[model samples]
Target chain A: MESVILQIAARHMRPLLVILSLVVLYRGHNEPGGGFIGGLMLGAAYILFAMGFGVQKTQKSIPVSPVILTGIGLLLALASGLIAVLMGHVFMTGEWTTLFSGTSFELKLGTPLLFDLGVYFTVAGMLMLVMFSIMEE
Target chain B: MLVLPILLPLFFMVVLIFTRRWLAFQQIFSLLATVILTFFSAMLLIDVQQNGIATMQVGSWIAPYGITLVADLLSAIMLVTVAFIGVVIMIYSPGFIDKGRQSAGYYPLAFGLLMGVNGAFITGDIFNLYVWYEVMLTSSFVLIALGGSAEQLRGSIKYVTINFVASIFFVAAIGILYGLTGTLNMADLAYKLRTIDHIPYINSALMLFFIAFSIKSALFPFFFWLPASYHTPPIPITALFAGTLTKVGIYTMFRFYSLFIVENLVFWKTFIIVIAGLTMTIGVLMAASQYDIRKILSFHIISQVGYMVMGLGIFTVGGIAGAIYFTIHNMLSKTNTFLAGGLVYQRSGSYDLKHLGGLYKASPLLALLFFIPAMSLAGIPPLPGFFGKFFLIKGGFEAGDYVITGVAILVGLFTLFSMVKIWNEAYWKKEPENIKHGRVSRRAIAATSLLALAVILLGLFAGPVSQITLEAANQVVFPEMYINAVLGR
Candidate 1:
């Protein structure tokens, strides 16, 4: 019965939590929210869904396995570093470009943000993997 | 860039994690990754040999403010040695590591271990070194506990607890040093330390670093954890640990002593000499009593490390060169011995000397493969270990340190005695009536033979190798080149 109430609440809360996590991840470099916290928040949301809908269902909801997610995250982070080397800089040296220039503030993208995104995915995937394994046990 | 060696392994580790379910793919891919890494490291070594030193600042930050990766002759040599060992062990591991462990993330963790090791060897900042040490400790902790067996758990607990404490002390020292000097860049710190007046806090920081590194290197009075735990892991893991892990600690000691603590060696010289003497005598004496093959090898590691420290304690160019040479020889010899011991365990189904017998009659080829490294480890003539010991003793005599020199020669005899004990018990004794002999795999034998060949080659080419080590030693003695390379002077 408790699970049913949780399931109903989770159905609405999951999307909101995921969106908020994205917002946190996107604003991480300039604001208080960053990859680690955003990843943890995303993982927490999935864990809540799992608690309500069962681990197997939650696993099916995510297209990739959590461990694979971690691998992808690491690859992304490493690629960010490699990109700098290719640009004739040292490994992991951040390279920035103006994506969209504006009068007030430019939409700038850089390797550091990519690295943070990689960290976000890694942390989220690792926490989720740990949670799912423990729940299964 | 200087980061390729480290990054390659990390990338492979992540890929291995994704391919864990596909056993064949994981095996093949891991092997491929190791091969590529070996090539990359060799290239790096050659490049550094030609270019003096390679330094890269991560994220475009200047030296002293950013994390820098620097590969001098010492780091490049160590990197190549580590990569070579990684390749041989990776080849030997497929038949050795169980299928369950493989599927459960062995390859990924192994690569993670390599990543940590490479990172430690290349980092130019002290705090960054601490971070790399943590990375290494974490991966090693998982590798040791992979099976979750009772013995493994016991060993892993001890290993983790001791190393964790050591790391805490390491970080604390780094914090104090950073607070005092306002920099963590080793070259920058060297410059800063020279300009400042002697302070009591600097001595305290040095002492803290000494204790922390001593534990990691398994120096005397802090080495009990090594023998208690090293034999509990699987043979391949043990072999890898024997080759690479503790050496990182010793390397750090060499680096720190040469760069930061050289000015204050008068305060710590005798202390290091005494520790070296104790570490040598006690480690070999304990090895003589151990019945398990791996345990015996583990104790000798401490003994051999003592020899290297004795070189540093002597504090001369020849002494440091001898230490570097001995380090290279020991890394190969020790890993080969453990690999050969693993083969013995495989054939006899036991690591106990009492239960093992008659390997000589069963496998003469294996016997010879084992003999080369075993005797080399015992400082047999024409082998690398003999030259390493000779130079060290000569260095000791040159320094007029007769007492430690005598202790070193005495310790060498005991090391030979322990090696002979293994030969007598494992190869000469008659096989027990009920013992079953398993056929050793071709890959294991091939891997052992490859390392044995390396030992032989190093011995045969001692002149050129000695030259390289001499150059490396000179670099260690003078930190200006390292500083200039990193800071772009």
Candidate 2:
């Protein structure tokens, strides 16, 4: 169902799109790009792959089912909220910890980032699940 | 913590999701989770009763800025009621739902719906309420079509379409509200609304809210989707929804009405009264004509919701208290009636009353189980429904709304007639020829009996329960108390 040129383009675009989506997801804590946008990009990569390659081939490449990925994503998001409960803070209060603080290259991590990552996986998985189900059908 | 009722469901949702492959594990774990949810919800209610209103700021943020989870008496009561219903549904599901369906993410989806309902009940911010509504809708969209039956799928399409429209209206209203008040926190919005009395868009936003909540709660004009879609799902799922879903809309309506829009109080009260009258009259009249058990009960849900709204329209402490009590009573009895209908279907292999007969002779226990909730719903003396009606009517008369009170009284008669119609057709008549009976699960039957007992106890302890609801109503009727609790003003 696919042309050779289209297939070649999808093959290169898939990895690049995934890398861009991951970058978007990581920088989402402080910048404008966040889980939702990154998740869409990740999902778009799969959708592109599915369109170029056959549905069965794309299914074979996915390591886990989209449904399970959504479950894992929900768990991660819930765990991020639970962190505050554990620290004797209110539920969902963001707890930030500095990584490489004294160095010139310092990064900050927090539950908000974890929550964004969860949203990232959830949206990606949900999008893939819907798109794949439709395409396969 | 006040947040536990909302969080417990999410935790169980993940557990159920990972365990969806094992039906046995999912069932047991779900049951345990519902039990814990109920316990915690009851504890919250007790805490709210002992020490005034309880508010928890999510993530340790300030009340006006962050999402606040408030467990005032009203939310606490609703939490307990919803959680109790969840426990009953979890117990009832294992027996009613097939193994294949159970393994196909039923438990997880059910908990997802629960999480949404709990979140909706306790959220102190208006936008958070909308988010929870989406959560509930997403789970419901799947759950309604879970069986993959042709008719079920068809019904789900209508259900999904109608609810999405309601959500659009809801979100649009929120947009207007946020634009007008510059705040999303309900308490803060209420405080701001009092100072700005000249805004005309407030009515439009409120009208939008009324339409949205009315649709979600399935009031008279917007009720067609409920009876059409509710019967398509299996009995346990239908009963789960029958007990919890519409009440969320009603809860929000009460919350918003009691707290916001003080400038239009008289107008909203009159509008609510008119809607309440039409809703009850139309809803009961529709129920009187339905032959199918689930359809009858489904229509009855609309009528009973009218009673709650009527209580709201009465606009007194007694009236709102009555509405709260009526809500709790309806949750128990309505779910009980649906489960009893499921049992009838189990023993007779049909939901159509015309094809059903002689259950009184065949199973007196089932007959008794059906009788208790049915009579309670019909508002028989010494039942909670009677007291619910009593409170609402007394409050209505006190408020000098005799016409609506009369409508409420007459609706009671029609409600009784419908209950009697089912009683006669399903239990009193002889068994129809060629009827095939399936084995009824003892666990499901036990769950039904336990729910019926709750109805009975609600009546027996009406004195104490009413006292609590009245206190809750005091907070509901006064926005200052709620705002003070939330903002420490």
Candidate 3:
């Protein structure tokens, strides 16, 4: 017996929560939010969806396994570190680039951002894995 | 290059997480990774020998602020030993581990354990050491409980709870030490601590570190968890743990004591001497009473660790060199003994001595393999253990510590007696009539023989090995060289 109201609220809130998490992840390097917090928010959003719609429905929606996601995340982080080593610098020495240095709202990119993205995926995937396993039990 | 030893296994672990479904791939890939790591570590050892202590500041951050990976001679030798044991265990595992546990992420967890061990060996920051210890402990917890048997669970619970408390104590000490010194870089702490004149607080912090490491290293009163838990894991896992885990604790104790905590030598010396005597005597006496092969071997680990601590207690170059040499010998011998015990279990179908007999008749080759490490462990002449014990005893005599020298020699004799008891009960006695025996797996034979060969070579060539350990001892005693290397002075 699922609560219809809770389901409706979850349906309405998930997109917003996901978008907010992305915003947090994007601004993490310069602001208070970071990969771990953003990932937690993203995990919370999916967990909320699962809670309202049931784990089976959530699993059908996202067919990929969490373990694979964790693997990808770890590889990404490792690659980010190895990129520096390949360039003959120390491991994990951040490499930076500016996409539009002359513009007011310039886009900046770096290995640190890549590393954070890896952490985000790892945390989100790991939390969901734990949550779904517990929910199944 | 400094990161390769750590990063390689970590990468393999992540790769293993995905390849867990492919048993053959998992086995082959993990074995390849360990072999590569062993080569890399040996290369690193040689490089460090040439370069005079390799130091890497992570992410290009300068020392004293950033995380550092530093490998002096002590760290280099430890890394080489760990990687070698890891290779041996990987070779031993496919034949030893059951299929159920193999599919349950054993390879990943083993690599995780290696990552932590290597990280602990190389990290130059104190807080990072704590973090690496946590990494090691988490994986060990999983490995110990991998099978989910009642005994395994009970042992893991005891192991986890005690180690968790020790970790807490470790972090608390780190916190207090950080508070007092305002730095966590170990070399910087050494520098800062020398300038600070607060003896009482420093002594208190050192005591906390002593208690925490004592538990991890299985020192006298804190060693109950080791004997209770070690026999519960799979044979290969137990052998790996026997070879590496407690030695990490001892390594940290050696690192911190010789590097930063030597100023208060008087208190530590007397304290270590008392603990060493009690630990050696009590561990051997307890091993004499245990009938289980793994349990007896586990108890002897604690006893042998006492000799290392006794060397440290002596606080001289000869003493530390002895400790390092003993550590290397014990790591190989202990692992081999466990592997031999596993082989015996494979052949005889029981670890209980009362229910076992006639291994000598069943397999003369197995008896010889077991004898090499067992006698070597008992400090037989022309073996590595004898030289290790000799150095420690000689150091004790030179330091005017006759009492500990006496206790060490007595412990060695009892160790021999217990080894002989196993010989008498398991190897010499008649086989039980109804028991069926199986041939030991070739893989198991290969792994044990590799370690046995290493034992022989180390014994036959104790000169160069002792030279290396003496160099390590010199680096340990003189922290200034270590500080200069890590801090770029």
DockQ of each: 0.76, 0.85, 0.75
The pairs that clash in candidate 1 are A93-B59
Q: What TM-score does chain A of each model score against the native chain A?
A: 0.93, 0.95, 0.94
lDDT tens string, model 3, B88-107? 99888998889999988899
Best by lDDT: 2
* CA lDDT, candidate 2, residue B479: 73
What's model 2's TM-score?
A: 0.97
Candidate number with the higher DockQ (1 or 3): 1
Q: Cα lDDT for residue B177, model 1?
A: 89
Residue pairs in candidate 3 whose N, alpha carbon or C atoms collide under 3 angstroms? none
Off by over 4 Å in 1: A1-24, A31-33, A44-58, A103-106, A130-137
When candidate 3 is compared with the true two-chain complex, its DockQ is 0.75
For model 2, state the Cα shift of residue B213 in Å: 0.8
Q: In candidate 2, residue B415 scores what lDDT?
A: 98
